[model samples]
Target: MAESSTARVIRLRPVDDVAIAAVDVAAGTGVDAGGGVVVARDDVPRGHKIALRALRAGAPVLRYGQVIGFAGRDIAEGEHVHLHNLEYREFRRDYEFGVDARITEVLAEADRDTFAGYVRSDGRVGTRNYLGVLTTVNCSATAAKQIAARLRHSGVLDEFENVDGVVALTHGTGCGMAPDGEGAAVLRRVMRGYLTHPNFAGFVVLGLGCEDNQIAALTRDVHMRPEVPVFTSTIQELGGTRKTVAAGVARLTEMLPIANAARRSRVPASALVLGTNCGGSDSYSGLTANPALGNAVDRLVRQGGTGIVGETPEIYGTEHMLVRRAVSERVGRKLLERIDWWREYTAKNGGSMDNNPSPGNKAGGLTTILEKSLGAVAKGGTTALTDVVEYAEPVTTPGFVFMDTPGYDPVSVTGIVAGGATVVCFTTGRGSAFGCAPVPSIKIATNTPLYQHMTDDMDINAGGIVDGDTTVEQVGERIYRRVLAVASGEPTRSESLDYGEEEFVPWHLGTVM
Candidate 1:
């Protein structure tokens, strides 16, 4: 049952009915399946699953010792197990709340890791020091972009060595929905989060007249650090687009000196709140990047830092696993409530949770939502699930937590950042290009080919684990160290390419009217 470094197939568990192809396998090729070698009955692409034994139709296919899906037809040994033969089926899950929850061994303060960070007057640590221009509605998006563009390209930031540069946080919706509905409430919460985000030394809120989301109302209850300067205005009040842009530039220009005065100081790693997400995932995701990231998250949690994992729909089939790790039955029920809400939400929209695992995911060897969710949940590590919060809700708990957000990358990460995550760690097998301004994002590749193909975009290659060149703990420790370096001012690949501005999408829910 011992696997060699060059094993052509990987069996994750002793009870698994299938093994993952370590490389593209041609028909007639023999692959090691732990118990015995199985000859391939069909060509299996790398990262795809291969049946270890004959499976009768309607029987469950197991991976990681859990059911991934049901066989639509009889599957012969070594046959490729994918869309053509696998089918999604609903099943019951027992929620044994707190059954697996365990206390984390927090490191002593003197033994904890440290990172150079900008400490705000509110006692929060910031990973980046940028001045942000936030838009109240899509109508003022252009003005916000122009203000940031002018400052970025004008050589104005060169004078302030400590400031990261000005960024425009714009979105597509703000005016078309009811002001008091869930949509507006969500938008207001997101804007307010960005307004006071510790990463921004100062910020300006711009709005266009006649929008349901008024600048005044959005900023009404927002309380910011007194040292952080904030300016709010509208296009009509400032005369026009030209005037608004010019006035915004002038105000930020005045605040630049004050923002630049901030300096990075050594802070305990406990001050870090890590946001974890995965996109463009493949079968190798669970084996390589995702679990490796989870290891790193465990390390962070042990150091007394917080780790947030989201993507609610993507975790549908694996919520029971998390429920067992919940710190309390109340917290576990809260997560179940969100899952129920998503079920109703998707059903109301005439969609199914199986709508996920896009074409890219399928090509990468995922067959059903159940199969995908099993891999997706690996990013949370084995820490106790302390709290579950609504989308864009501030994450106050110190251990591992879950946030309710869609599987869409941008909206999910945006919610995490809004909840006060200072840095983000993203894993991908299909090469998802992403970034979050102010909050630095570290991209980890699930396989070697994708990392080499998109070398400029990927920050770490977790593929070493798949290739037998490294262990999960080694790659995980590397990711954890890279996180500290990035938080201490290292620019990530996405940051160098300026990918954050356009990716700041908030989840738009409810009616447009």
Candidate 2:
């Protein structure tokens, strides 16, 4: 639907019965709805939707050309349509496997884009060369941080021009969870993922000797790579935290020169794996940033790059769209399996999937998780779903793939990063400053105000598309180019603000002991 030069309402699609309020519409505000003029019956917040026509109770409410929900009561034209009059309901979705799957038009290698990156000894291309300090247990978290702090405060990183920085990849689990169950396996998978990640030139995994996740066990179970140096130690064996920190510092000191020796060289865009998620989302998220990101994702996939779309819960109601694009029925069924798992998991915990859309989401024009999910899936782009991977598993497929993860921003991004995402692209409408280190994060804002308010943390403004200042493809191109720049060592806004430290939250499965 072509919006007028000064229109205050956005009809996302021609057939849609609702128009998103481009600006706050006070009661009695009049607007053109294409067929005729409509007047606001109540105050409607910007980003919220205004019904374009009358609806009887239980009638379907549509947005983005899909059913968002059913009207809980009679909805009058020009009235605010939100939590008060809309309600969530479950219905079967037709997931036609491989119905939309298509072979991507791959750009020729010589004509494809390239980015400057560190070429690891094992032939893996790296975006950033940082020395990592991983901890197996919460008890070792401080020691791990201290190790990195020792290098930071000492200023040794200044000499290592090629090295990005020393990062303490510490966490809060590994001691009380089931030592041999799925919980323990998940932690080990995450640890190994970070250890084998191409971004880290070298790393050390430290642990509390008495904890279930011991340093010795990690080394013994892990298949160490010759090209990547991995060292290990224990607080109990190293005497104490002070001694362990000293030992960690000494070990990393010995590796600084080697880390610094690494150099960036031209690499194909295929080497990059992008992880995308939307949090602090609002109604405009789907209409703006998320769709813009989806366009970028399609661009990356066409260029032979990998793009991961995760956050299983966030994709709940809209999953049939992805399942339809699956490369095979096996892949499609795998996605359904995870959806069932979440339903069961939530039920077991005495909760419902609709429990989300936290108060902030409601104020931002989202009513139910189903509505939020339908919008969130827009980040995946219209690429074939080549594969579906479990949480923390390696993503070996090249084009677009799906990784199962919770909707929690940090946890979902963590699993995606662990699955070999070297860079993260996060979209937000209400605003988010989240970042994933080792992997640089590029933030895309869904609204103009959010971008303006969080300019220091936002890297790109997709809101311009909403303001009709730019088109979706235009912002999408910027996002795709920004991903390459970040991979080539450009610092994103969140990286500049040092926001990746406390965001390293691994998914905790099962109950604590």
Candidate 3:
């Protein structure tokens, strides 16, 4: 409601034919139409689009100075521009490598910003020193969680102020499928990621002993040596769930001192690994919060920090935009290759890439996957995309990196965090309640209403941009600072609510049979 004096309709670009409604407009109500006024032809809801001028059938519908869709039928002035009149179309977008890539000015080593973090033996800097309880199969989830519960309920961590908390990461699949198939490979990658995550001071991997996801195999393969602070056992081998839980408790009790021994030290921002994501997005996501997050990404990247973004399907239409920013043609090609993989993956799964833009997205004014994607990638900021990584793969390259994962928020975030994101920033137009353990998630609300209604869940309000109170860059700076603070041990709302233990969802790549 802040962008314009009228506050009723907003035309983002001079060439745009559609203006977004800041509030619900009644049918026949006069709305400011640039230099003049036009009456609404039909009732237009808030955050929805309204045609600024008459449009013929198949005419390109423009928003944000780019074509979002085509008019499905003749559209009159001041009419709603949505699924009723708009249509999605497949079009080829040009991919030019390194065309928009900008090399960041690396801060002088002595001038680099810093955060208080737990510097690990492997040289990774962790924002939180958490002892993790990781499950290798659905059957072991309960036991793993019980172990974490015992630790928490016993007030065992009160003495370990440096140890953030105990988090048990449980998932639905690990068995009941071919052990060497694509599904197993994907599961292994997720397991490896969590086991090797920097946040965990130490981790206990629980298994059923017979599941395809063997903890033994995971450690040996992902390059973890036996002396590492990873403890693994199985329900069957330990006699039963109770015995297994007891064993876990004993091992972790001993590990408490070792894990708690980790202390925070000042580390450069180069030690920072950031994960950027958007969920419950609307038309304003690209216009405000996401771009603001992008600004923050640029700031961090310049400090030699890593910014990881994923949710492959969400990047579908905007792939070209990122391709242009790739540091190398090879890096650009890696992104395209992932896109191709998604296409085939979806087809085999009996779906389409266009099947994205969930019902909530459409209700929030996103029309197609293309439209949603163009908004989603705004979180990446304007930095050279230095790397493209597989789902759950460890990220070695700094700067902005793309990870391949499904568009689902929780699943996507898992891969990002698994890939070594030390902190996370999520933007949402509608409200979302999500958090990542070890890595704190700073939630940004895109509009004033959601910000006001969901104050408890939201940390930053980019709603100021919509209300005309602040610029995106101003809010972006706020986010950048907040991220550093959170990394330095400030608690996020979701973290305060204890919300991350249930969200460890790994991407399942193949069928059960």
Candidate 4:
């Protein structure tokens, strides 16, 4: 609330174990003993946390008064506890499935409130109006793009002011892949999801038709049906590539007006599905941006919305925290199963989860997966873990759901969006240029320096946490407001930069045959 300056202190929660500095405390300065104890023994930055009391070696470190991790060594009062002295310890996690559970009350309220989104006859809502060009295989990518290019040249978009840019959803893999196997199956499902995604006002499904992934089979598997506008084609049927492009363009010309008729209206927050992720993370991510977003997650959940925290590897050492808050042990165990799968997945792939924390993260003061995870999990806030899902599984539970995905920034985020996240809140310290297709991404800078330097890229300055200018809740509220604004039509920094199209990379587990 107040502008950042010296002599300001803020608490994250009423019962928080520590207070964060509103301004950077000089080295060797005596921090006044507030109602709580001094925790920082070193020169602490504005957004960093201080201890509430003396901590013994191996004692669990608390933030939001929750066990984020354990102190690897002794931590003195007023001393900073971070990567150097904290270690991740594995223990048997206790799961309480379906016990002492609370159903989200907001779902009931959302049943009544509605947004003026494009209500597809299929019963899904479209936040933005757009025409989509879908390719069945790599063989058809050029043709798909050519069709889109022709539409652009024809003044087609100029005629449809309400529609967003026509997007050609093409990728590297499709044919030469096994037709009925794992990779093919996953890719097929993802493609189906996009074809049917509520965001598209209209879509054209194009295929070379001779590839292993035949257009007939894909349509059958996806149950391809739409209440609004849709056009389908095959290269063989349209007289090959050149003829197919002409046909596709002709089809799009007719669909433009129908796509342009959609507009945005006041929508209740419940219609919002917020995707939570962090990238280029630093020591302060958990302390500032993550928790700040967590508060926003809680606020959204309170308002009858959905929040998804993905990146299964990022949640490695801190999953127990989520388990304890799980509405059902089944949900908690589902998360654990994913964690176990990753362990085996990495080992078989000649890697380990500990091999995370990219060079950038280490330079920013992060050490191991355990240390990074402590901060990573903070983005979920204090809500009960409502559900755990497989990669790109449609998120049905409203509050907070965890989707299995690798921690790779682009790949992980793609899974979150595919799972139906309408808006994404991404936290970064080293600055990342990431975007989501159909869905918009909101980037929050973890520290003030990066925020100011990359003002064009970052949407929110959670670095205020380190500057001692605002509390986590204040920044959280700021992010929450931005989510609503972006959902309602404000373009995020990533959207302005056109950072999502080529970055539509889905995670590939096996070899690219």
Candidate 5:
């Protein structure tokens, strides 16, 4: 849906009870509401909702032709609709599994697009060739960081041109938890995924020796390509932090030439596993960036590639839409099961599913989690939900799939990347600074103002859609092409700023003790 530059407000659906202000609309301004012009009763900030008609207290408000919230009190026509008057409440939805699962037309092999990538010995493709330092416990984080830092800043990488960069993948909670509990299992799985990740030419597993997450146990039965070298050490065994760092740097130094020997070759687009996520969202997120990213996801699916959309909590209200698109009842049911799990998970933790749409989101015009979810699910596009996997689980299904993950941006993205996403497309209306190492993240801004404000961080301006300067398909095709180019070794804005190292967060489940 495109809008005219002169449009004062945008009505997403004919049945929508509200319209989004295209710009800051002052009180008494007459705005066209499709059916007729309505005088604004109050000032409506850009991206905020404006009621199209008066409604009594307890009346349901709709947007995108679905219920977003209920009115807290009587509202006048053209009144600003936001948190002060809108409130969230539980409502039932029909799952209707497989109701809209359409068969995708996969591009013919001869016509499929290709990108330059490194084909690993295990037959997986990698968009980057890098040596990584993996920490088994938080106690070893400093040593891990020092090791990666020494190699990265030593100018040693200058000799190995094929290497992308050495990175230390550290986390905050590998210890102070049960060894055989859910949290430990998740940590181990994430570490294993990175160990076998095609993005890394090789990696070292660093531990604190006395932590519950021991290197021996973590690597047990885990296999890496024989051609890929791996080393394991502990601060205790290495004597101290300085010695551990020295040993790590020396070992990785020897492996740099081996890593540099790997070269990129043309691979089919099917080799790409694109992860979709949105953060720092505003009302325009649904209108612009998210839908545009969804369009690109559709294009990738048509090429026989995989697309993973997670952040389970953020999709609460719109899950029924995804459920209907599931390719099978089993896949749809799995998604609902995860949703139920989150409901119980949040309830037991003294929280409600409605505890979302952060302060930044509200400040940017988002009101409720329901409203936020409607926009969030647009990142999946109109593709069949081929499968739903647990957090950090391997994503082998082609086409679009869902993963169970928290709404926190870093944790959600870490799960997606761990599940084998070779590239990520992150949409932001409030300008989220994020990156996932090894797998590059492409940032798309939801509004022209945010894009122009953070030009250095944003990769594409999907905001053009809201500006009436471009269509969703146009921006989507641009995003899809950018994905290919980035997969072929083009540095994304995030990578250029070296933003991925600090964002390596793993989902922490169960008690810290």
Candidate 6:
């Protein structure tokens, strides 16, 4: 399939049962949709959908050859297909393993090619250069922010355009929490991931000095390198808050020029680590954006690249599909273990995995976790399950892999970035304005109108599926192309809007006393 711009009407698949026009057309315009459909109606807009075949009430509307939803009412050929005319049905999916699966053929020496990334002292590749300011507890958050704020006033960035920014990573749950429970363990994993993240050019650790999470323990557990220009200051050690902040700023200023020298150069696609996630999701998310992303995931794996899919609770019930594709029993076991962990974790916390599908999801037509999982799994595509790892563990395999993480958007993406994802692709319905620090994020809109309404944040639109204007494979290919463009330095919508600055939220575990 070839790529086309969003300037005209385009039909994606012959079996698509629909044709989507690029621009909106009015009714009774004698529309020639190329498949024996006359202009039965007018007024189709760009990115809107039109039917290719006649659909009856309760009949399934197929895209990507999967039932995305059913026709809510009878429709004629060449008519528009969207939310008003369709409703999600109760779907029971049978696993047809490898029915459409193909193994990723790794070419000789392809695995050895690398991107011109900042090879961290710890052996991870970073796609961005950033100087991070770490706070040991919420008590020091204002101080950490003050330190970062001082950099702007000091003309430090004037000499460091190559450096992303000086971000202060602070959270709400660092002290008074259980020191050795699930909360502590998750917090440690998240914190360690940030300290060792390749995107950081240099960092400074700050604290009130006497909080339960000692700066000393964080430094030890996070494994700050002896040579990475890490400076530490506690209010106690530095005599006061103002003094501590001053010390941190001074150390970061010294590291600025060193970070600024890092530059972007041609990097092989395999060096790309892609993070896959979906938020504010609706029924069309699994149908359009998710599968489209799956196609990009397949292409990246074929190019010897790596892609990571998180959101453990969201994948419940559909995990068996991945297990059947697992390359080793160990990998399968690891995945199952995470699922088991989530089950126990949620049970202890007085919830269930089925307690998902926010009010938005239910209103938008998704009924149950079973329904959502069948669609969510489409994000992984048809690749063999390469490996499974815990939160923030390094991703070394070159194909599709899963990371265990909370279903929360920020936390899940945090693990992906920590595990070394250089970029992220997020799919959303009902619009999302999320951004991430260190790694770049590209947002794909699940429906067309949402893309138009929130153009400031959306990078791609997968609504063509619902509009009957494009095929899933065609949209998938479009996403793949955008990935290459973003990797090659094209600024995504989030980047253009400077959304990265406020998005560096780390997961907080444990509870305040």
State the TM-score for model 1.
0.99
lDDT of 6 by residue, 1-513 (tens): 212232234444556554445455567644444555356354555444566678999887754344546788997876766656755555565544334334679655545344456665665567778888877778888888898889867776877778777888877667787766666666666777778777787888887876777767666756665547787778788988888888888899899878777666655677788999888887667668998999988878888888899888888867767877777767777888998888897888898777877777755546456556666788898888888988878788879999987778887888788787888999997687787776779899988988899988899989877676888899988988777777655668877676664565556654657
Give per-residue lDDT, candidate 3, residue 89. Answer: 85
Superior candidate under lDDT, 1 versus 4: 1
Candidate structures ordered by lDDT, highest first: 1, 5, 2, 3, 4, 6
Report the lDDT tens digits of candidate 3 across residue range 396-495.
9989999998888899999899888989999999898898786799999999999989999999999777666899899999999999999999999999
Error of 2 at 397 (Å): 0.4
Candidates' C-alpha lDDT: 0.92, 0.87, 0.86, 0.76, 0.92, 0.74
Number of clashing residue pairs in every model? 0, 0, 3, 14, 0, 23
Candidate 2: C-alpha lDDT: 0.87
Q: What's the C-alpha lDDT at position 277 in model 6? A: 89
Q: Distance (Å) between predicted and true CA of 428, model 6?
A: 0.8
Q: Write the per-residue lDDT of candidate 1 for residues 1-513, one digit (tens) a residue.
A: 235344478888989999998888899888887788788899999999999999999999999889999999999998999999999999889999999998798999999999999999989999999999999899999999999999888898999999998889999999879899999999989888888889998888898988999988898898889998898889999999999989999999999999999999999999999999999999999899999999999999999999999999999999999999999999999999999998998899999887879999999999899889999899999999999999999999999999999999999999999999999999999999999987999999999999999999999999988787999999999999999999999999999998888889999987997
TM-score (all chains, Cα) for each model: 0.99, 0.98, 0.96, 0.84, 0.98, 0.79
**Tens-digit lDDT string for candidate 5 (1-513):** 423334478888999999998899888888886778888889899999889899899998999999999999999998999999999988889889999998799999789999999999989999999999999999999999999988888998998889999999999988888999999999998888888889998888899999989898899968889999999989999999989999999999989889999999998999999999999999999999999999999999999999999999999998899989999999999999999999999999999899989999998889999999999999999989999999989999999999999999999999999999999999999999999998899999999999899999999998888777899999999999999999999999999999998899999998987
**Candidate 4 vs. true structure, TM-score:** 0.84
Candidate 5's clash total is: 0
User: 100-175, model 2: which lDDT tens digit per residue?
Assistant: 9977988989978999988776667789898999999999998999889888999878887898888998888898
Stretches off by above 4 angstroms in model 4 are 1-92, 96-103, 107-116, 223-225, 236-240
Return the lDDT, model 5, position 442: 97
Poorest 10 consecutive residues by lDDT, candidate 1: 1-10
lDDT, residue 214, candidate 2: 67
Ranking by TM-score: 1, 5, 2, 3, 4, 6
